[model samples]
Target: MPATAPRRRLTAALAVTAALTMGVTACGGTTKDSAGKEGGATATGSADPKAPLKKGLTVAYLPKQVNNPYFTTADNGGKKAVEQLGSTYKEVGTSSGTDTSGQVSYVNTLTQQQADAIAVSAQDPGALCTALKQSMKNGVSVVTYDSDTNKDCRHVFVSQASAEDLGRTQIRLLAEQIGGKGEIAILSAAQTATNQNTWIEFMKDELKKPAYKDIKLVTTAYGDDDAQKSFQQTQGLLQEHPKLKGIVSPTTVGIKAAAQYLSGSRYKGKVKLTGLGTPNDMRAYVKNGTVEAFELWDPAQLGALAGHTAVALESGRITGAEGQKFKAGDMGTFTVGKDGVVLLGKPTVFDKSNIDEYDF
Candidate 1:
C-alpha cells in the first residue's frame, strides 16, 4: 500500500517547522497528493518538469555502510549534488555493510528528524520495508540506490545498471577468461540482496545459452559483503572444487576479497576472476594477473542521480510514475521507468588497458 495521506500532511507541517528552526527555507507551492493526482501544476494543467527542487530542504543519504569505500565514494557524490542544489546534505549508516537491523534504526532516526528526503541503499529488500514505509508516510521521500527496498516502501530506485545487462556481462567475461569451457563458481554478496539475486538469476539464464553450454557452474557461495568472510569463502570454494577455473563475484567487497585470496594461492595464475568492482580496488590484482577484467557502473554518478531523484520527488517536479521526466543537473534528464526505477547507465568493463582511465 502507498503511504497514508493524512499522515503525510502532518509530517509536512513538522518538516516545515524543522526547516525554519535550521534557518532553511522549506518547500513551498502546492504539491500533488500521494496518488499524483491533485494540486501542483500550471494553469494549463502542466508542470515545469525541469525545475529544481525547492532550496534548503534536507536530504539524508544512508548507504549500506559508512566506511565501505564504495558507499563512501557514492555518498560523497550525493553530498556534492545536494550542496550544489543549495540543500542540507547528511550521511549516516552502519559500519557493517550487511547489518539490516542497524540500517532500520538509522532510517527511523532520519524520519524522526523530519528530513525532506531519505536516500538509502538497503541491506535487504524486505527487512527495512516497515521503517521505509513509515518514513514515506512521514513525508520523507524515500529513494533507494545501489540496493533497493520493496517497491511499496520507496518512491524511486536509482539502478546502477539493468539486471539483465549486468548478469550477461559478468558471465560473458568469465566465459572468455575460462576459454569458454570449465567449471565456474559464484562468490556473491548477501544472499538476500535484491540486486544480487536479480543479477544472479539473469546470469543463470545467460548460461543456458548455447555459446555457454561448455561452461559448468560448480556452486555459489555467500560472502555477506564482508572482507574476511568473503576471503574465507573464496578459500572454501577453491578447496571444495579443485577444478574450479573461474569465479564471478558481483559484489565489490566479495570481488576484492576473492582477488586477494586468489593472488597468493596456487591458483594465482590458474583461476580467473571477474565481477562488479571499482577499478582502484581491483587495480593491483589486475596488474598482477589475478583478475583479467571486471564490470561496474560509476558509483559516484549513481549516487548523484539518486540525490537528484530524491529532490525531484520531494519538490514534485516529477512523481514516481512511469514516463514522468525530470532533469538531474549535469547528469542530464531522466524518465521514470517501470516500477519507479531510474537507470544510471550501462556498466563499463575495466581491464588493465582502461583501468588507468578511471580514478574511482
Candidate 2:
C-alpha cells in the first residue's frame, strides 16, 4: 500500500536500524495527532502558489532501500518531475532498507551539501528525528514519501493514501477470498516501519467489527523485507498454522515472496493471499493460481508528487499548513491535510483481468 517497494518493503535489520527494539507500539509512530503539534523546524512564511518556481535548486531523494526495484521506480519518477521543474535531482541511501544509521548519515550529508530540500522515506519514526530537525533548522525543507517520520521532524509528508484505507482494505480483500471464516495472519515489513505499523493498526481495528468476527487473526510474522526471509516466513506460517486460511502481506516484497512460496507448494490456490504488490512481480503468481489480487498506487506518481511538494516548499508555495494547496505538475492540485500530509490517492486492485494494463 505504500510503494511497489515489493517497493513497499522494509527489514528486520530493525536491529541495525539504530538498534531499535523490535515492537510495533514500543517504537514511536507517525500519527497525525502527534505530527500536528506545533514546534519543530517548519516554514514560517505564507504560501504563494503563483510565485515562479525557483530553478536550479538542489533536491535530494533518500529512499528506504536503494536497490529495491519499486524504490528505483519511485526515485526515477522523482528525478523526472524535479528535472521537469528545472531543478537538480540526485539520490543517496544505503543498499539495505533497514540501515537507520545510513539514513541518518545521509540526512546530515544532504544538509551539509546545502541542499534546498530532501525527500525521504523514513526508516524509523523517531530515530531520524534529531538529524531531520537539524536539517530543518538549517533551512532545508524535508518531505517524506512512502513512509513518514514524526510530524515534528519534517515539514511535510507525502503518503500513498490514508493509513486507514490501506489497512482496512487488506482485511476486506482477504475475507472475501477466504469466505469470511478462517484463520489469517499478517506478514509485515520492519517492526518500526511507520507506514507498515500504521496500516496494521487499522487492519486490527477493522477486524474488531462484526463483519470480521468470524475471521481469527493467528499471528503476524516479520520477514525483514528480505526475499528469502519472507519465503521462509510464509512457509513457517503454514507449518505452524495448518488451518491458516490466508495471509495479508502489506509490503510488495512480502506479498511477492509469499506468492512464490505458495505457488510451488501444496498451499497454492488453497490458501488466499492479498496485500500491496507491483503488477510485474505478482503477474506470474496470479497466472499460476497462487493469488487472486493485490493492491498498490503507482509509485512513480507518488514520487513525482513528492518532488513537486519539495520544490513547492523551497519556492514558498506552501508552508506545511493544513488547507494549503499546490499544483503537482500534470498530476493535479493537492491539499495539505492534517499532519502536513499529501496523499497520492486510493489503492488500485490488480488481478488477472486487469493486471496486464499496468506495467509498474
Candidate 3:
C-alpha cells in the first residue's frame, strides 16, 4: 500500500463522523483505520482533534512542491495530526512543476493569508530565509521540514534522519556490495543542499576506514534531484570510469534514476545502486535486480512527529530545549535537541524481501 492510503482513510472517517454527528458526538466509539486497526474513542474525544477550536488560529503546511509523492504523504500526516488536535490545516505550496520563484511566491501568499503558523520545506534555504524571517515578524510560527531555511529564520526543523547516520549507512551498504574495492561515484543533489553536502562529507570520512582501504571515490556528480539529469550523470559516470563498481545516490530522485538506468544497461548486477528512496519508487528496480538495497524513514511518521511537536510547543506543553519530551501521536515520543531540531529516527535499509513491507 502507498503511505498516503492510511491517512486518506482517516480523513474520510473524520468527514463521515462529522456528518453523522453534525460535529457533535458522544465521543465514545470504536473506529477502524485504513489498515483495519481498531481504535477506541472516549465520550469526550474531540470529533476533529485539529479543528482550530481556538476560534481564530490557522496552521499551514508547505512542502517543497505540492504534487511530489513524498510531500503529499507528509501532508497527510500533518492533516491527521491537525484532526487529532481539532485544528484547521491547509496545505500551501507550488505545484509539482513549480520552481524557486513560485515557492517564494507561495511563502508571500501564506504571509498575506495571515496564517498563525507555517511549516515549510524550503527548496533553497538561503533564498527563502528572508521570506521566512518576514513571516516571523508577522507573528507566524515558522517551522521547516525536509529542507531547512536556516537556524535564524525558523524556530524548528523536522529532519527525517541524521546526516551522519544516512551517509555512513550508504557508505557501508556500498562497500558491502562491492567487496570494499574498486572505484565508486556519488550522484548527489544540488551543490547547495545542506543535507546532501553533509552526507557526502560523511561518506568520504567513512570510506577512509581500514576495511574500505581499497575503495576509491572517483568523482561526484550533481543531479539536483532531477531524474533526467541523474540518468545522464549515471551514463557519464559509466563512461568516465569503466572500472566503477558501485554508485551511491543520496537523493531519492537521483537514486531511482540511477537504478532505472542501471537496470536497462550492461551495468545491471555489475554495479550496485544504494541510497534514499521510497518503496514504491524502488520496488521494480529492487525486484529486477538493479538495486540491492536503499534506506529511508517513514515520511508519515516524521510529519506526524513534527505536527505533534509543533502543537505541543505552541500549547506550552513542551519547549525547544533539552530534556523535553512530548507524544507524537502514532509516531510515539521524541525529545527536543540542540539548535531547535528534532530527528525522527535512524535510517532503515530496505531490500527485496522487506521492501514490500514498507509503504514510505
Candidate 4:
C-alpha cells in the first residue's frame, strides 16, 4: 500500500456493532463469498457501467513487489491517475521476496472491499489465475500491468514491448559494449517466468544471425530475482567462464543485484552488465563503468495506462483489438493490440548523461 492509514473512529451507523466471529483467514486474505460470476464482464449486483466513478471508487494495484523504485514510480503514476479521475486507488504488494500466497490473500481482500477494479503486476500467471478468476467473478474488472496474468481472466494487459524487442535490444546493447564478438552469459530471473523465458528464447535466436554468430552465448543461469543469489551467480560466471564478456538479466531484481555486485569488484570494467533494470537501480553502475547501458520501459506509465484501459473497458468505450487507439492521461495516447494488449513502447537505454533526468 502507498502508506498505511491509522485506525480511526467510526460512527455507529458505519460500525460493525455485532461482532460475528469469522474463522482466521490466510495471511493476506479476506472473508470469502461464493455468489459471484466467473470470467465474464458483468456481475449481477455490481455498479452499472455508466455509473459515475465517485470519490471512493476503490481501485487496487497489486505489483510483483514494493521495494524497487520502478514499482514505486508505477504507484506514483497510478496515484496521479486516481487524483485526476477522482477515485480511490491503492498500490500494495508483498516485499519482492514472498511467494504467490500473499497475492492470493490480497485479491481476497480486494474482493471483500468490493473494489471497482484491480490492476496487478502478476508474480505468476498460473498461480494467480484462480485468485484473479475469483475476483473477476465478483464484479471486479481485471487488468495486468508491468507483467501479465492468465489470458482468460485478465481483460487488458499493459505490455512494455514484445519479448523479441527486449531480447534483441539487450543483445544489441552488449554487442555495442563488447565490440560485437565475445562470450556472453545470461543471468535470468526464474525458469518458469513467461516474460523472461520468451525474451531469452528470442535472444538466443537473434544471436544465431551472421552479425551475432561471432558473439557466443556461453552459459545461462537462473537467479530467481534474489540479490545474494544473483551476486553469487555473477561470481560463479566469472569463475567458470573466463572468457565471458557480458551478463544479461531480463528481470529487474536480478539485473540490479548483478550490477551492484559488479560495481564493487575487480570485474567492474571486465564483464559488462546489461538487462532490464530501472534508471535508479543502475544509475551508479552506468555512471561508474560497471555497466555501459541497460534497458527498461516506464513502469509507472504502464500502471496508469492499465488503470485507464480497465476503466474504459468497464464503460464500454473499447474492446480488446489491434490498432485501437486510446488516450492515457499524462502518458499520452496508446493503441490496443489483438488481445486488449497495450504496449508502453520500446526499451529505453539509459547512460550517464541522461540517467539523472528520469526519476524511475
Best by TM-score: 2
Shift in Å, residue 339, candidate 2? 0.9
Residue 348's lDDT within candidate 4 is 76
Candidate number with the higher TM-score (1 or 2): 2
lDDT of 3 by residue, 227-338 (tens): 7888999999999899999999988888989998999999999998898887878989999899988888777666676677656645544435444566676566676576
Per-model TM values vs. the true structure: 0.87, 0.89, 0.81, 0.82
Looking at model 2, report the run of 10 residues with the lowest lDDT sum: 13-22
What is the TM-score (0 to 1) of candidate 4?
0.82
Superposition error at 53 for model 1 (Å): 2.4
lDDT of each: 0.81, 0.84, 0.71, 0.71
After superposing candidate 1 on the true structure, give the runs of residues whose Cα lies further than 4 Å from its correct spot.
1-52
Q: What TM-score does model 1 achieve against the real structure?
A: 0.87
Q: Pick the candidate with the highest lDDT.
A: 2
Question: Positional deviation of 318 in candidate 3, in angstroms?
Answer: 3.4
- Residue pairs in collision within model 1: none
| 238 Cα displacement, candidate 2 (Å) | 0.7
Model 3: residues with Cα > 4 Å off, grouped in runs: 1-56, 95-98
